[model samples]
Target: MNSEQLIKSLLKQEEGDQLEFKLVVQKDSIGKIICAFLNHEGGQVLIGVSDDKKIVGISDAEKWEKELTDYLNSAIIPEAPVMVSLEQVGNKQVILVKVWAGSKQPYIFDGNIYFRRRQSTVKATSQEISNLIHNRQKNEFHWERQPALGVELEDLDLQEIQKTVDRSINESKLDENNRNPIDFLTHFGLFQNGHFTNAAVVLFAKNPALFIPQARVRVAFLEKGKTAGEFVDDKLLDGNLFKNILSAQDFFEKHLHTTRKFSEKEWERQDDYVVPMSALREGVMNALVHRDYSLPSASMSVIIYSDKIEVFNSGKSPLKAAELKKSHLSLPVNPDIAHMAFLRGYIEKIGRGTIKIMDACKTAGLKPPKWTTTETSVKLSFPLNIKLGGATDGGLVGAGDDNINIRIDGAIDGAIDGATTRTIRQLTILLAAIIKDEGKRIPDYKNITDLGSVRTLERYIEQLKDIGFIEFKGSAAQTGGYFITDKLKKIIK
Candidate 1:
């Protein structure tokens, strides 16, 4: 807003979190107010404005502005960058000093650390001070170790604990001792004095999203980058970390393509993912276990684009991407969560997740995953091998050991009367794509179609197969695939 509009807006509002009115620049107290604003969400101090929201102009704003700048340079511990400008309010001149929210927390003035709470500048409590220090130094931050309020032992999923124990025992990492869930939690330090830590809440809570609103993984299948465009499959994966991980994996598996090749000796079909599932899982688990939960507004996310998938978590890595690409130490943001994930066989070699993902991508003959970061978030993007209408030696189907070309035929017109010719053509194109490769199940077909229910699509497939236009393959128990018949090819011709 312009100076006049800004003044009018500021005058209309009361002095609160983002704004404070001062009649004059009090040299001693002004620094404290600025420090408080810097420590909290940065705010504006309007000089020449009265307590009652009157626009009483300052006599010498230029003089006071000079003094404020000089004081700021010399008074604060770390210099706070601010914008100080004199704006004309009617006949009066009001100085607007705007201080932005600083990345450096606990900005100190003189000997005290100040914080802005509502309209007052208060000294930070010991715990608040500790939190500030921890926020600045990520390695020292233990947000997961902090107790999750309103959480109880019963809130945890007993099945999760059992699964962890079972995995540990099978791996011989733990003895098959029948320790109770509570005792096991205590042993891992997730159960503190009469309370569950945030780590415990994340790993085992029936719905951790209830305790931590931003704990869930947000997955979006976007047509365009970042925007939810045509063909979007946006969903928030909630519940405990394990459940979210599984849900995210399911989402990826549905959207991603697979390459199929037959083994000569065994006559067995081997399916290779466009992006390695292991690498994707590692990325997801790492995001879940190491995200900065202290950032109450931020949540982890898996965004899938047509050509790529991005997995993001709040909080930048302590180690740089280049450093991680080489040998580097792992400094997990949530150590307690990471520890539990490690024990559960979710994460391996604490610091090797990045290297492994890169190696996996290379092994699959795909481009290396791109790692990018901002001050508040880390993102890993894995590019997809196939684009729209892009064809490889085999398409998105893995049936038995043969490649087949099946032409769309009018022979199914009398047999299947429900669907339109356009719909049938679309279905034919989809099945033909599969036939070019091996074969695909209903889920893969649903992904290709991306518009109908599984049961509905299954009926159509059955009708086509029954009419002798398509043939079925693979085990009946499994979601087997369909191939166009040679007899139908003659009818179309």
Candidate 2:
């Protein structure tokens, strides 16, 4: 915010949350720095401040001001202008322009989102892209109406919209009055100027391909048919939620091997390795809901190779990929989409899609699906382990809700990934520590016991002792079992 600090930041030669500096020999490089701040972490770009931090003031400040203003407004998408200020440090002048991160992110200059990392202005890595999205999400960015051009509301499939409304009225409390799709969008805060947002278009447009040319959900048979075995089938998926899911399920079942279950009657058949309908429903629903429509890319894709099924979409995540790996992860890209899926019975409100997928695969005896995400995409892989065979006979149970074993099992699975979102749950041991001093065993939160919270508290106490995160000074009892450790303070920090 200040030239003195900006000069210091430039000298440090370190890149992080904010701050980048450049010695621009010409105006083109100025564009790069401006784009860098807009695309990644918001920062102040200081020119005339040498890369090594020596300030050399511009001889013509007015010329540089005109140069910067022209580039930021005319050359950026979701067009955001940079705020430029000039300062004199010792014998030199510095041109400082503040580029705030965009609300609709992935800010492009000449067609790509340029970002700052340490000493360079380059393409942002997937993680950096994802973080930009996380920050922008808090400032009211919606998936639709971004990069808006080439389409209108009526261009969308009205039938699809009507059916969605019908489903909402039939199953949810959306309205006795607001039963129209247009009204539904208004009710959902997705309408501007009486037209649908890009989210609406991508999720339910009759032919989203007309506007978003790359918009699709492809199902490929990779590792087969003699190529890299990759299928780039440029086909479109359309219709109501049920039909769309059914079609996607059909595509998945095509790749599966089914078996005959001989019962008392004639017979029943099942896929040898079907991706659980529940999981796929949740996954695909998430694909539809959480996708980053701001980017000019595909809406969603499901690629089934020989070893696994990879489901991908433009998912703007709330956490870094490393943080996601370290904690139990759940960040809905679109809560309204989630709510819609929940009422329609495709997904539950509990937000444990990973748990549901794992359970369905387990009861059917398949290895749990693996998850990997970058800023632009989230990919979930369900292994083909034919030896595990297709899960048959276990009816779909609530993996995300109405289940405790599911949440506990999720904690364990996530433990394999290093305990992502459940960090606070682990910190609940502090809840126990605070009570242990009062000489009372604070029993449990009987109301929300479905979290297996009581069991987790006891296990956390045991774990704290085991790893030295806590200690027991006296003999163990129902009460007065311990005091926290040095590690506890580290965790507190």
Candidate 3:
């Protein structure tokens, strides 16, 4: 809908959590409302509207829009994402200020955090502010922020901490003035309230495995069709997160096959590993940075198979399996750890690690990486140049296993070979949505597939039903929806 129609529709509604009406543009009141909206789910502020749902418009909306935009940019901490526009109602103009939920929370206005309480904007309480801070850190009760019991300055490796500070300064990620280990720890929120946090221990502890056993990584090399326990060689890497990362790289270099070939065209020799080291390094860093440290009994693992390698960690990604293939938000399970990893030049803050892994594999003429997540763990698999059912002539293998490839190939050839590319893409999207959740109704599929008409979506759905990929269950009046059939589930498995 256009802005005029949307404003007219909102005019009939009362003030609520996401809707606020003001007769004038007061910087103080408007700032509070904007801050509250950012702290909560996003909202819209309609200036020149009264409390009783009157549409008495403003005199000059252009001036108000620019002024309010400037005020919010300077007043709100961290510079909230807000849009100010002038919209014409029936006979007058109104200033519409739209705010989205801030990824970085606890938006402060005039030194106080504001939150929306139903239809009112008020200053946040101490407990509410604490919750916002924790939520901004991406965990309700962040394990990394907790005090490390029995850990002191003596327990941490002072030299390693100093080296990190130096490296960060050289990388222009930190100010050179704060060169002390204590200062570095305090600057990164690793030291708080006169006590060292668990993050500090994980990053600088002399023997982190002694205190946090799960901080270690287990690397193993298994033959074809072998279990994890029966490994040809394995090692339990210890020390800090950075140390373990480097040690894992060393293990990969020693075990993974490498080839050196002379290129006459270039007058030089080229060397490469079976899989790109960049992809493996990224996978390992992701496993460490995103691991669930609260699960003290669980540890990360790097398992090498004859045809693939798997990096497994005890934490579920906030993103869905299909979402990883596209652009998505970066919702790190451990924000503190992720931030430190970024500063050290080990990872990026944006959610591009998976994309980088896939791109690197594709550039190397290998199959794209796959991400699989369970209720409590996430595993990333990288394929190698080994044929499963055919002769191995040093060629990249296909994406999935033999059974899945056969089933999917047969289904596609029999059902969708004659369909248009757009229809096939829509079918893939529909199947992904249903696999993610079977209770999705027709409307949900339409929204996901971006189909403007239900009739068009039903045609695609009918095709799937005819192919035995999905089946309808229950009645339309009751809890009825399209669900994946056993044939599709077997192929997925």
The lDDT leader among the candidates is 3
TM-score of each candidate structure, all chains considered together:
0.52, 0.45, 0.55
At residue 74, candidate 3 shows an lDDT of 66
Candidates ranked by lDDT: 3, 1, 2
Can you tell me which runs of candidate 1 are displaced by over 4 Å?
1-141, 170-172, 175-178, 224-228, 262-267, 388-493
**Candidate maximizing TM-score:** 3
- Candidate 1: tens digits of C-alpha lDDT, residues 115-196: 8899998898888889877775652236776788899777889999888877755643444553578877775667878888
RMSD (Cα, Å) for all candidates, in order, is: 20.4, 19.9, 15.3
- Per-candidate Cα lDDT values, in order, are 0.69, 0.54, 0.73
- Across 1-493, the per-residue lDDT of candidate 2 in tens digits comes to 2345535545565645456566663556666667886666556666775655667668777677666656555566654435565756666777766654544567777767778776578877878778777866754555544433555666766666676678656642345577766777766545656556666666566666666665556665553422454453434565434456777887766555442221223333222334566766667766666666566654677766544677887765666544432212243556445545554556532334555566667655456677787766777777643211122211111112213323322323333334422332323324332322422332532111222356665665555456555566654564454555665444433
Winner by lDDT between candidate 3 and candidate 1 = 3
Off by over 4 Å in 2: 1-141, 145-153, 223-227, 230-244, 261-273, 319-330, 387-493
> In candidate 3, what are the lDDT values of residues 76-190, reduced to their tens digit?
8854446576878878999887765665688889998999989999999889889888877774247888888788899988887887788767754566766888888887678
Stretches of model 3 off by over 4 angstroms after superposition: 1-140, 227-229, 261-267, 387-493
